[model samples]
Target: MPCPACQAPSPCPQPHVGTAWKPSPDVTVERLSPGLPRRLPLRQILCLLPLALVVVVAVQHRSVLADGFGHLATAEWPWLLAAAAATCLTWVAAAVTRQGALVERLPRRRLLATQFAAGAANHLLPTGLGASAVNLRFMAVCGVPLARSSAALALYMLAESVARVGLLVALLIAFPDALRIGVLLPDGAAGPLLLAAGAVVCVALTVLLLVRRVRTVVFSFLRTALSEARSVHARPARALALWGGAITFPALQAAGLAAVGQALGLPVPPLHMAVAYLAATVAVALVPTPGGIGSVEAALIVALVAAGGPAAVATAVVLAYRIITVWLPLLPGALTLGALVRWKVI
Candidate 1:
């Protein structure tokens, strides 16, 4: 039936009907913008000021760096070979750590690739945050929840720290006289002991804070810190696995450094290199600059020098370590990033 002032087909309306055509409130609507790829702005490029500073430092040290290359040319192949082997082991350790974190295991190949990409990003990114960000992105793409990813990163990081501390403590304890007489530790060996004590305190505090009751109350004051550490306690088995991996990872890295020392004909002992490795790593990790570029180079060189190597020898060893660990992985990581893009993983 058609009835209305405008002659529309509808129910009859006599005289004046209060009928009005209206859409339902439940409809979903959104604005649509035309597709146009966005370009990075110049200002955004300028945001990489920290990275630029690292480049400047590297350039400024170029003269000393040239000599390091000469040292590498005359170096033995055995140590280089050992460094390569240790590098492989270090990646394997990372994969093991990741596997331990989750209920289900991710493919070892994928995890290895992810770690490589993450490490590469960390080397380039400011504040070493890139690696964590990459890990999170990769996990999200794989359907892992944010909570799980957070926990995994924390667990592995904590485990690695503990392993490093343990190794250094062992070295200090085993060669008490060496530490006692060394210029760096010369305070009658008290300095190294004190440092070891401090590391123990940090470990003790970590355990105490993990208690449920204390976690509830103290967590408020430690909100940010706790939030960061939340992933460490997500799963007990996972934590154990991560710790095992962490211990192996740093030990392998120390081995690599030791190999570099040997290749360059430096008389630095592998065991002593382990202690220097821990100290240099902690210093670099604490630096505000991304991946500890300038700071890492400086810390490593300084530590190696202090550990009885000459300036030239220290420079060569540090550069070699950077090459094997940092630059060697970058090209593959770039390719990995491209593959990730093609697969729509990020």
Candidate 2:
């Protein structure tokens, strides 16, 4: 029998299966699809979550905020602007590095914007977790298989860590007295620490090799990671972007801190100041603070003092730098994150 409404077939008023039809402009009806995991009611929740997080973080760190604002009052605007510019460039560097970790090319603008949004997400959770979640979701939405996306994430992290430590070593070699790195470490501790770390790695590797099932899984993952790495690095452009962006990310961060130190008249020289920033970051890499908030500040201040800046001045410089790099951009970054969620970008 013909349908009364459409006068065509048995079924009446069939819904459109394609994206061209929507029930409403503001509302979204999500039909489940492979590889896309989330579809939350985003309009209000997205806005409120960031707002609440802002309040919570603010109330918790009010004193630090007060001190930073005090130092910021007398900051040199020109150099502060330079610091801001360098901070922004870190996002571009991250986007490039991420692209370099995979064979397929990502949409440049969206990747860059996702990094920006990832920054805010990063601060809200523990070190690396928030950004990893955001990027994983972004990759999933981009049609990447879960296993390959995980491999890419691992490669990106390994490359970034290597580049950061390598840059720090290069800087130390270039300027032997740039910062008193030995003083940053407790006396006679490095040897024991190194031995302990080696032992731990050896034990873990031994267990992995001895267990048949474990060894099989480990080899499988290693093969995947190596294959992906080779494929990405096989292309010169991707390889260059990977290593170049990895190096640039840390270098720009150091430069931004140096510029802020200059603005605040920290007694340390600019290059030495940069060395301080790098050493501080490297030292605190193991500390699991949200964005390394307290730990990073303390390490930076200590590093600056080791680099010949006065204790008081180093404290002020760190405060100002954190304000510019973290707090100042936080709200806008959160808003961008919310917007991306609403648009189903991540």
Candidate 3:
């Protein structure tokens, strides 16, 4: 008699009509294993979380966003274009500075992308925190030791600070009355401020010394930093990139502000505008605001007003400048950040 399951053949050995045939254990395991639930990567979740927050913020500030766009529409196109160009150059300058800080050469495209992503990150976190975290992670992924990478970060910051101070000094020399530092600082505040800063530094050093582990780590970091600094200085191009990029970064930033002032008809001289930017930024460097958000805007308005700009126009210029430098690039920058996270570049 022919089998019901296999009609062309005789009765089959395995049951196929009322019962199912089972495979061997190995095959069964192999087939079923793939069906087990797999967890999502933590990194992907982290990357998406920030994006969600950004979206929410964008929605909440839609009106402000619209206003910014409106201002851009009415802005003097030539000067605004120049400001945008300067804004673009700031990212390149940052990438160059990062390259100069590290002894090993990083991939060019990834490095620049990192800087762009860092800019977005900077806005999300407190002043400098986002960029520092991104760069630290990037260096770690690129095979740099944590201590050395941190030291490199320190070196980069120091270079930038020195350059900024030098530029501020030069500007003051050229235009002594451009900005009145006294107006920014209240009477009898300078001494207290200096003392407070000194106290903070002393406390920090004391903590480092008191904690044996921290002291050892700090010593090691200092040693690595010195070595890395020497290595960086050995190459002329790298040295120039480090210092020149540092100098150019702030100059470009100031230029962007000046250009925006011109675009909005702020009535302040270009040099005065630059001085105001430098002074405002330096004044609020320790404010701990995200990208110096509220503090920067307030300081900038005050500085510009002090520099002889009318209050209303100064406010407009500051708003427009923030729009150009911060808000415009934010979405694209956020996207770049996510892409870098997905690719494990940061």
Candidate 4:
């Protein structure tokens, strides 16, 4: 007799008798199982999508970009170079902060690349969502548990916020008149703004205290974050990297704006320009705009004017600074982000 399915000489008519039938090595199991799912090409699509979007955005904003470059062309080269340097250093500062948040050591190159990719993603999503999402993925990929990663992210954010406010207060103490809130706001707006901010904080605190489930989650998160922070601070290098990077990050950003101001011949003093940059960024930090795009530009322009620069000049400086700090690196960052996706780095 011969086996029916895979015909071969056999003692019995049954397919399983004598010798078991087997598909040739060249045939895959998928060939036998018709219902097997094919692998999706999602990673490749994700890798390319951002790059395509970047090109489209660049093309659509060609005129504005060209004008910004034109301004840079005639501006002071040395100051522009310094601004570029500061822009580059911001990535490094970000990477250091990320490393400080984790106890495990990430590969240096990949970690830095993740930060670069995170920067691109940050602009694509509202506030810091893009960056936070990327970092979370990266940490998970690096073997950090989800809860720990989330805690580390919270700690990083807290540290950065504290450092920014501390720097702002220090600057205000040093230059009391650098920015007048009264001048920036309408006659009756300042008091209302303060009250609104206070009300929001109180509401949030009340909700956290009143909701049992929410309070439990919040307490769990805080405990995890505190534990992680304590562990990180136990090591001197990590402590320095966390706090030092946090402080330096905003300072470098402020320096970049001041450098741009100098490059464009803005009449604001350097310290005043720094103050304006910090204040504008801090004020717009809560805005849900992607990378604070529109809000940041408007705020920066206003802050610069309030800091004693002419409105036209302030506008020009803001445009130029955004070009150098945001627009120029955008394409490269997108490309890098896509590469990281394809490589499964995030």
C-alpha positional error of residue 46 in candidate 1 after TM-score superposition, expressed in Å:
17
Q: Comparing 1 and 4 by lDDT, which wins?
A: 4
Please report the candidate that would top TM-score against the real structure: 4
Which sections of candidate 1 miss by over 4 Å? 1-68, 177-240
Model 2: ten consecutive residues of lowest lDDT: 19-28
**Per-residue lDDT tens digits of candidate 4, residues 1-346?**
3455656677545546566567766778788887988766999899998888777667866876887888888789999999999999999998998888878788889989998888888887787999999999999999999999999899899999999999999999999999877657879887898999999999999999899999999899889999999999999898899999999999999999999999999998999999999999999998998788779989999999889889988988998998998898898999999999999999
Candidate 4 accuracy as lDDT = 0.89
Clashing pairs in 2: none
Report how far residue 212 has shifted in candidate 3, in Å.
2.5
lDDT of 2 by residue, 154-202 (tens): 9999999999999888888998898876668889999998998899999
What C-alpha lDDT do the candidate models reach, one value each?
A: 0.69, 0.87, 0.88, 0.89
Which parts of model 2 have CA positions greater than 4 angstroms off? 1-47, 210-214
TM-scores, in order shown?
A: 0.68, 0.84, 0.86, 0.89
What C-alpha root-mean-square deviation, in Å, does candidate 2 show against the real structure? 6.9
Tens-digit lDDT string for candidate 1 (219-266): 553553355355444767666777788788888988889898888887
* C-alpha positional error of residue 181 in candidate 1 after TM-score superposition, expressed in Å: 8.9
* Two-way TM-score contest, 2 vs 3, winner: 3
Clashing pairs in 3: none
